[model samples]
Target: MTMKRIAPLIVSLMAALVAVLVVGRPEHADAKADANPGAKDVIVHLFEWPWASIASECTNVLGPKGFGGVQVSPPQEHVVLPGAGYPWWQDYQPVSYQLQTRRGDRAAFATMVSTCHAAGVKIYVDAVINHMAGGASTGAGSAGSTYNHYSYPAVPFGNDGFHHCGRNGNDDIANWGDRWEIQNCELVDLSDLRTEAEYVRGKLVAYLNDLISLGVDGFRVDAAKHMPVADLQNIYSRLNGNPYIFQETIEGGAGEPSPSEYTGIGDVTEFRYGDVVGNAFRDGNLSGLQNLPSQMLLASGDAVAFIDNHDTQRNGRAKLTYKDGTNYALSEAFMLAYPYGTPAVMSSFTFSNPEAGPPASSNGTTNAVNCSSGWACEHRWRTTANMVGFHNAAYGTGLSNWWSNGGNQIAFGRGANAYAVFNRGGTLNRTFSTSLPAGTYCDVANGDISGNTCTGTAYTVNSSGQFTANVPANGMVALHINARTTGGVTTPPTGCGTVAVTFASSTTTVWGENVFVLGNRAELSSWNTSGGVALSSATYPVWRGTVDLPANTAVEYKYVKKNGSSVTWESGGNRTINTGSACTLTVNDTWRS
Candidate 1:
């Protein structure tokens, strides 16, 4: 949880709560081993999803899609603000450690974890242990737990169990560089818990053990950056079974506490990964991502990699999201396709209004997710879900056969087990050398393997270990040894080096107006508007096309609109584009409408 709070309500006192168990799982039961699942794990954060929907996705979607696990939102009872439309961040304001949340009750959560585990998928709870609801009186909590700045009867934490925030009139993390202030101070007036106290730690331990008993495999420690690392070590050391724990310690630049401070305690979130990946692809610089800077997160083995998370995606630090369209999807493809850290898929609901909660009832209890109800089920996209299989197939293999067009165009193989080619800034019609046993394999990028048939394109690896294809602009293709089409494998004949060059453009036109692109080159119909290739308006206000063109040629072009006998030419200088020396290139532009 980042420290940014939406709004606040007056806090009150704790109410009668249930007694928590002190002991953890039985002695013989392991915490570490039990929490960590097997290899090729790709954890998807089902942000704010209801427990029932998560269960259904595990059986009908996650299991079949090869997702290793899910990182669910914080399930603790929290403050309910009808006035705020029940912002999703409300989950972070813990009123109690109880697992009953607006998403579902305790029974629902238990069922979800069990169901997911049964389907070979683990459940990682997002543990918000740092603080409680803000304010000092009159709290309105979801689970009916009454809480004040120092009184949470649900956990029965009183004045002594929390920090004296207003004692000397402290500021809300006024200086991020000051470690003491960051740890002890209240975040946006949220009551900071006394994790340093043994009493609080015991309650937290019991809560976590309870979750483990309910079949939770691990936890994502929220706002860990705001808590003491030593205290965290203490809490983990007292646990019964080793639950996989990854702390949410966002590296907010140099002045913030180094994420390394909490590294030995558990796996940490590497926020730098997304920003770097986004910038590289956005700027058409592929090689930049491969060579990470020292300041960036490079300990891939011990870090969690993602294109964006809830906070960064909403707060503008994350460079890409569903809103970015093609580039957004491209980031995920590139991340998963690369042999780096464990990848996480972001599955979130759509909201033009950032503070709005998930699809919910009038009371803010989230309704079951149905994709059509304003949720972006990105994990279900063929491009994302299918890549999980490829990531699994290529696990533990070292990167080999690295090749690049010295620009954004690149291709590489995973030790002959799999191959991937990427093209941005234009098209990619280049061949790369490989060492695979010649055979036909499904291009997992286009689609998944349905039994013996590849739902995508089929490519044959030549006897000499070479792959040839023309990836369209903002497109890519992938193949793995494990995903070979039944008869897709074959020996390649001689002469396999050329790739298709696709010329493309985008423009906005009013209704009834069609856009056409023509240029001063043979590929552009020799600048003849009537003979020019027709652009598709299937995506209204935008047009695109892929055309076969001679490689290594420079051309000038412009867009023209036609409707019956009427015609409109873009009023501007002739646009110039280049076909790279390689077999592919892309000319991207917008009409000067």
Candidate 2:
């Protein structure tokens, strides 16, 4: 998130005028690698998360759920402003390119990259290359490197590397219309780097290349609009590989640099996406969203869409947050369900004060993530997390079977792979036509399918491709091929001779202990405690997972709660199931006290 919210009233007036002007969408960059390297397209920004916590989440949560990538906070040495109660923006102020901060040291950063890669999830670093620390910040950085205005000795950037654009008494940006001042002048008194200078470009390239060498797959270039597009292209050309680059170019008025100017090089952040989607959901208007792509600043392929980022969430621009409850969840679900740009989901910590930092120690080092407490963990919401599977299953499919009440109720489909309905008003009772084949699907938005049982609601599509449902107010029902509750046909098709067994356990757990299942067969780890198949808590108090067990086999399994090395087995004789010749089966069990 960029701090470009200066003179918003003026910018808004100009933006209204610029919206009508037609401009050809720039061709997307051919040199860029896949923004999401995994099979899934959704990426989550774990805002202000510690390196160790992020590594663990990648293995246990993101990778297992098919999340493609994680966008981490800046890993470079940055200003530490303890006097100001250690504001979150401090991490955006770079003191040097050294990979050391409250998050972790260079070694920890390297470990995080490799760990996430092993889980098949990519890491995109928030690259702060357009500037250094603010003019007022003068102190030793998080890495113990001293830094002052225009003189970061750790990065060896002397005063010559900065631009002293002679305008506005303090050389800070004041005119929102002047393109030159917007790019050359300091933004809110941050020491702007002269990106046009070769020396400065070389230093930026080195920093990015260093991260690449450590296995980082991409970058979220902060304050990208403040740099010349040519300068960015030149720097990108020198980087090791074709890393995914999404520039932060907030859509501005006609005179200022437009997001379109930056899309030629790579995908640009579509800030308008949040405002449009947020307001629609907030105002209970579903009809306008049908024209969502036309209302955006960039083309779908050249844009990175998001509802609210770290900055927008605090700046009063966000129409909804975790505080908005159901509306926010619906907004995220709509973003994933709709075919738009690559979606970036935000996972933020709760904050009362706008400038307050994340949950941290006395010394300001960010603490490990505790989703039940300080963190919102919105990305892990059953609706949001499960929508990722819907998005993936619906990939390469086009919109079909569109239905709407023309007000607050709507339903749509992604070809034959997925279908969804949203009701922001009263109970919506109607039959929905879809392209999906005849079968049973779990309503992922409300619950999940474990084995053959649906935890929330189950809807069966008739051979004619239609189902009747009563979607409640502020409620949603989404289904996809990946979450089919019956039959052996999965999104990626399980091979023959194996049956899908979904294990649903109605058991509670302490904070640390998690529910897992181990059984007599190899698929169930042969009662090996270490090899227990972990179940998902997305729908808590009902841990569930689907395992492909051999057909025509008798399996004995027991649910256990594991906290580290300790395992608490359910107090019961072994529960048995006969995997008959049927392709799918479900075994529902309650933990015996």
The candidate 1 region of ten consecutive residues with least summed lDDT is 491-500
lDDT of 2 at 585: 66
Candidate 1 deviant stretches above 4 angstroms = 3-37, 165-171, 253-255, 293-295, 487-593
Worst 10 residues of 2 by lDDT: 4-13
TM-score of 2: 0.78
Residues 309-354 of candidate 1 have per-residue lDDT tens digits of: 8887777787888888778887888777787777888987887877
lDDT of each: 0.72, 0.80
- List, residue by residue over 1-593, the lDDT tens digit for candidate 2: 45521110001323223322321112222233333332355889999998988998887877666677899999998888877777888889888889889999998998897677656577899998888887775778898887777767766655667889988877888888999999999898888888776656667777887787676777999989899887888777666545778888987886888989887777888999999999989989987787789998799888899999999888888888888999999999999999999999999999999888898878998755557558889989998998987887888787888888899988999999999998888999999999998888889899876666678898889888999998989999998887787643643323223455668899989977888899998667789887666676655788766565666888889999988799999997999988875444667888898
- lDDT against true structure, model 1: 0.72
Best lDDT among the predictions, by candidate number? 2
Number of clashing residue pairs, candidate 1:
15
Itemize residue pairs with steric clashes in candidate 2.
Answer: 451-502
- Judge candidate 1 at residue 250 and give its lDDT: 78
